[model samples]
Every structure is written in structure tokens, then in C-alpha cells.
Target: MKFYKHAANGFKIVLERKITMHTTEETVVSFRRVSKIFNKKIMALQNFDLEVKDGEFISFLGPSGCGKSTALRMVAGLEKASEGEVQVFNEQPKEVISNTNDVAFVFQDANLLPWRNVLDNVVLPLELRGENKQESRDKAIDVLEKVGLKGHLKSYPRQLSGGMKMRVSIARALAAKPKMLLMDEPFGALDEMTRQTLQMDLLHIWEREKTTILFVTHNVYEAALLSSRIAVMTAGPGRLSALIDVDLPRPRELSIRTSNEFMKYVETASNHLENGSIGRELG
Candidate 1:
């Protein structure tokens, strides 16, 4: 195992060796002195610096308008940074998007086509790239089953419940066999019970697939339950306030959330956000 360190704003950031069995090479996504401004007046991000390790499950936890989504969008190449650079796999974010099929995105909404069946929705990415219809269909079916949607392949998005639709979205993202998955509050709209169920399902999929995930969420418990590490952001002009390593044991079951150890990490993360320590630390 190899260790890497990043120096930003005079702070030394060190990443621990991953304990997973998966051998995928460690890829670091970093924001180097990155900042974003709208109309030259409003600052969305100010000198933001963060590093995400390959195959690691991490979350961006902050209040709305904290630039959590903006950071992800910058990585997705959907938005441009006004200053500094955003790198993925050590290449520019745009280069990563255009030159390789290494990333996939899941938004707050399912964004499934209402007219398409679950299988077709999952196959859409492959189809767009002109893969064989028969082969793509086979792959999509496999991924749908992986997401626990095997019985719903023929069902349309309109016919499925909110949770099911999100499953379809996740299946579609996985169909491409992406190295990194970016999720923006994918379960935020569901009921609490449904949200917890999906969270468990997501963790299962992450473990099985071994894909690096950058999940954005406002819920502290959800972040604690899902992320191996949580990066808390400040209120505005967002920057990394704190990067808390979650020492929770893996193959985590639902009961784990109620354990004292789990709540301790959650409370620590909450305190960082509540006391505005994140901003102060960055400053």
C-alpha cells in the first residue's frame, strides 16, 4: 500500500490506505485552490481544496447553497471554476469526461424517461454510444437485477414508486461500469423509511461493485451511515471545513446506525457544522 499527502493552504492532507480487498488503482480527485464566482460578484466557492481517494465512499455534507453540488458539478465538467483547477484521476475534469468513460452521475431526481421501461432506461447509456442492441439489453438486464429491479425491467418509470424509480437510475449509472459515481441527494425526496432502505441498498451496491462514490447529502445521519469519510462544507463560498474519517466496520447493517460508535461519529460531524468550525479551520 502507498500513502499520499496533499499540501493546500499550508494544511497537510494525508489519506489512509484503503482497507478494501479491491485492487483498483488509487485515483485522487482534487480541487487545487479552486474558486467560483457568478457574474463577477457572488462567490460560490472560495479557494476550495479537497482530495477524494479512489474506490472510497465519501460524502459532501453541508447546508443548501454551500456549493456541495457545485463542487460535484465542477468534477462532472457541468460547470467551470473561475479560478484554480479541478482534477480527476490527475487530469482536468473536462479531459476525464471527454477522454474516458470513467465517471457517471446520479442527480437528486431519478431523471428516468417516463416513456421508457426500466430495462430500456438502464440501457440508454450504452445505446447512446451505439453499442449492439442485443448486448446492451443483456448488460442492462444484469445491472437491473443487481439493483434489485429484475422483476421491474418491463415496468415504466411512471408505474414505479419513487424509491423504485431511483433504483432504475442507479441501475442505469452502473450499466456503464463507471469507475466513479457522483450522486447528488439521490434519496432526498423519499420518505424517511424509504430513504433508509435505499441507503442500505446503495451501500450493498457500492461494496459489490467496488466503485468510488462521491455522494452529496444534507442529512447528517445518512452521510454518517453511508460514507467512509465525510467532508463538511461551510455555509457560503464553500470550502472544505473538515474531513472526518469514519472508522465504522464494513458490511454495515441497518442496526449499525443505532450503535453508540455510529452516533459518536455523527455527533462529531454535527458539531463541526454546528459550531462553524469548518469555516474557521479553513480561514
Candidate 2:
């Protein structure tokens, strides 16, 4: 495997090429020559390969129809690849979903129940598993605090700002203390300022939690900001286009976004995205 390592600020990230099938045992998640087709007419993914380490933050970036969400859904066990396999913690995603409590997903919308308070929303997953209410409540509160929502534990989703609602959603995901986080444009609905703020906050939480995260976004800047490695995808019939290691220093504040190095990476990835159609067809 080819490994790329870089240190910025205090954060260090390593990105490695997908391991061969014989070496799957060493990876936390592996997508082996995977493909997905819809209606036998529309191909959503094609010969894709990906491997994620135990605690890395990675992003899948492309345009709206690029099948980024499909890739994530497959990993979440919500969809199955038409060809090849997807393994989580060396087990199939379906197996992981049935037997383990090691993955969580944060969707674009908060998806919080209007009837549930912040604490209750955060504890719902644990509650479903028969965990004690009081214990789960305490765990929920701790994660809420981590997400900067401690004082708003009793607040309803309607009473919160879009950003705050997203925080509640994040708190709920973290409450599970999952080994991996699957985020599908989790901040897409927020305004620019709110999105940027939450992006920073997410980095802080990811740094502390050391959770392996697979984030999907169309925003080049957002992906560059939060990912240790950005995996650019081709247009529908999506395939890995480029796997770029983000070398910007971490505790990455907004200033890094303006730096020449940052722009270089973004521009390169943007070019790949722009040319995705041609690339996919040629491949």
C-alpha cells in the first residue's frame, strides 16, 4: 500500500492506498473493487476501492449526481453494492450492523424528533439497546457538552438554530461513542457562516474523539478543511478520481483556507471534479 503522511499544527493524518484483499484483516473498512448498479440501467459506482484506517477523517467529494451518498449508504448497510464487497472492521457492513455498536451516521438534516428533548434525542439509540435511562442520559449529557450543547439539553429542535440542531444531531451520534462516523453533507443546509463554524467544531470533536469519519460533500473548501484526505469522485458511475492528502496544518483555522497551498489542493481537486464526466467515460 502507498501511505501518505503529513503533520499540520498538532494533527497528523496518514492516507494509504486500499489494501489488497489478502490484507483486509488490517483495515478498519475496505471497499474491494466495488460497483453498484440501479435498475440494471444506471450504474452508480464502478470498480471502486477504498480503505480507511482506525481513526482517520476522509471525505468523498463530487457533484450532486456523483453517487457519494450511495457510497456512504452502502457502508452504513442501508444499501448493498452490486458487485464486490464492503467490509467494516474486517466484517461485512450488514454483519457489523447486526452484531456491533461501532458505527453512527449524521445526515444532512438534523432528523431530530420534534417530540424529544435534546438529551432524549441523544439517548434514543442507547435506549433502544436496553441501556439504563439514567446512565444513557448521563452519557448523552456528556456528549452534548462535548458538542457545546450542554446548556441546551432540554431545548426542543424547533427552538434551536439550524446550527444548534446540527449540534444536537452530532451529539446524538457521538453519544454512541462509535468507532466510525458516516456524515453525508451534515452541514449542507446551514448558512455559510454557520457551516464554517460547525466545520471547525466538528474538527475539534474529531480530534478529541479520534473517530474514523467518512464525510461526503460537494463543497471543495469544506472537504479540504475537515478531511485528512479528500477522495475526489467521478460523476455518476462514480469511481475514485483522485485521492489527495490534505497537508494543511491542523487546528486548521479559516486562515488556512486562503493560503496558497490550500488553494493549490482545492484547485486541483476542483479540476478533477469538473472533468469527472470525461474521466468516467474514458475509464
Candidate 3:
């Protein structure tokens, strides 16, 4: 039997077709005819619908004002959907928000507290939950090592570089071991080299942890590089434009971006963005 890597679950196995017979996986997040409006007038999203499977990396890709971030906020329970339904783990977003282990968010900014050193920053969530001090620290150290920050645990946020700060931010997110990760352009502010570095680290972390990720990005190449499927959106009064499946080989590397297959997916995404068709068929 040949080896196969399941992209959604990041699983490797050698098996025959019998064992690989299709089995339905659990849905981690669902948006059914979802719509979001701000201040009763601004239509940030309309008729958006999608289902995210366990351990899938899905990206909401669109230009500014297209509700990519708005949809992400709904999943994080930071914003309410004005119409339709938003569910996480089959429960309303509000229901899961109370459980710290259910969802975690990473934003454009690292948002690390200056007073707390690297280790403490990562441990803050567990500490606030009243976990045992030593246990919380141990967990923090483990995650810090995953992000290549074990040696710098004593460094304060002020002392860290921009990329390092983001690494600490990611370690903090992983420390909680949340079921789903919602990142709103987390590397948008970093330099190109640094952003690519973090992208690789994030992929490795995802492969090992097998966490479902909902990432919002305006960059087409970034989306194609990291996502299993991309939900391309229309400009303001946002709507789903196309759902392009990036069928690039699994355990992807930065070099894949230079490949013809990768560029084909990128071009498809760009075409959808340029044409801006609302509710275009999935590609």
C-alpha cells in the first residue's frame, strides 16, 4: 500500500481502499445563510454559508470591507450574526465562547502585555482560569518550545522583535489547546521574510496539533499557500464569490508557491476576486 496524507486531518497512513471508505467527519463550524450588519445599516455580510470540518484549514479571502474579518468575528463569538445562524461545535457561538478551550483568536497585533515576560504572557490564560501555577507554567513552556521561544521565556514583549512577538502570541494561543483557531491577518504587519517564516511555523504546528483553523486574509497567495479551501468574497455588502479548493499536495513547503500548480490555484483565486461575482459556484 502507498502512503497517503489526509489534508483535513493531517493524518498519515498506509492503507487499502477498504479502510479508506468515506466516513463523515464532525463539523467544527457552520454558517447557514449567515448575514451580518453593523449599526443597522452597514451590510457587512449577506447570505454567506459554509461548513468547516474538523482539522481543516479554511481561509476567508477578500478585499477590505468584504466581511472576511466580520465572519471571523462571528465564529469567535465577538460579534453576532444579524441574520441566519452561526454555530461552533453544533452550538451557537455564544454557547461555546464561555469555554476557553473551545476557541482562540490571533489578531494583526501580537497584543502581548508589556509587564509580562514571554512565559507569563503565554501562561496568563491558564492562570486567569485558576489553574495550578506550576502546571500552567509547564504547559506554557511546552507551547513556547513548539514556537521556538523556549530560550527567550524571560524576555519581555518590549525586548522582542516583531516576529518574535508574534511567535509569543501564537504560543499563548496554543497553550490553551483550543479546538479551533481564528486568526485575522495575524502576520499582516510583519515584513515579508518574517511573515513567510511564521507561515511555515504555523503550518508545522497545525500538522502536529491538527487544530481546525479559520484564517482571514486579503492576500491571495497567502490564502492559496495555507488553505485547503478558500471562501472568496465580494466587495462590501459581502457575499461568497467562489469556494476554490486548493488541491496542492499536503505537508506543503514555501517552495510550493513557485510551482505551476500553486500558481494555477493563485490565478483562480485572483480571477474570482477581480470578477467579484456574488455567490459564484464553488471551484
The TM-scores, one per candidate, come to: 0.91, 0.89, 0.90
Tens-digit lDDT track for model 1 on 1-283? 3333332322332233443534345656888889999899989898887777778898999988989999999999999999999989888888988877689999989999988899989999899888899999999999888878899888998899999999999889988889999999999999988898999999999998889899999899999899878888888888777777776888889899889888877777787677644435445
* Clashes per candidate, residues 3 or more apart or on different chains: 0, 2, 0
In terms of lDDT, which candidate is stronger, 2 or 3? 3
Instruction: Give the per-residue lDDT of model 2 (tens digit) for 73-125.
Output: 99999999899999888788988877777999999999999999999899999
Off by over 4 Å in 3: 1-24, 279-283
- Per residue, candidate 3 scores C-alpha lDDT tens digits across 1-283 of 3223232233221111111111137777888888888898999999987777788888899999999999999998889999999989999887887865779999999999999999999999998889999999999999999999999999999999999999998999888899889999999999999999999999888878888889999999999999877888889888877666666776889999999878877777787789847533322
Clashes by residue pair, model 1 = none
Between candidates 2 and 3, the one scoring higher on TM-score is: 3
Alpha-carbon lDDT of model 3 = 0.83
- Candidate 2 clashing pairs, residues 3+ apart or interchain: 8-249, 8-250
Local distance difference test scores for all models: 0.83, 0.83, 0.83
Residue 239, model 1: lDDT of 75
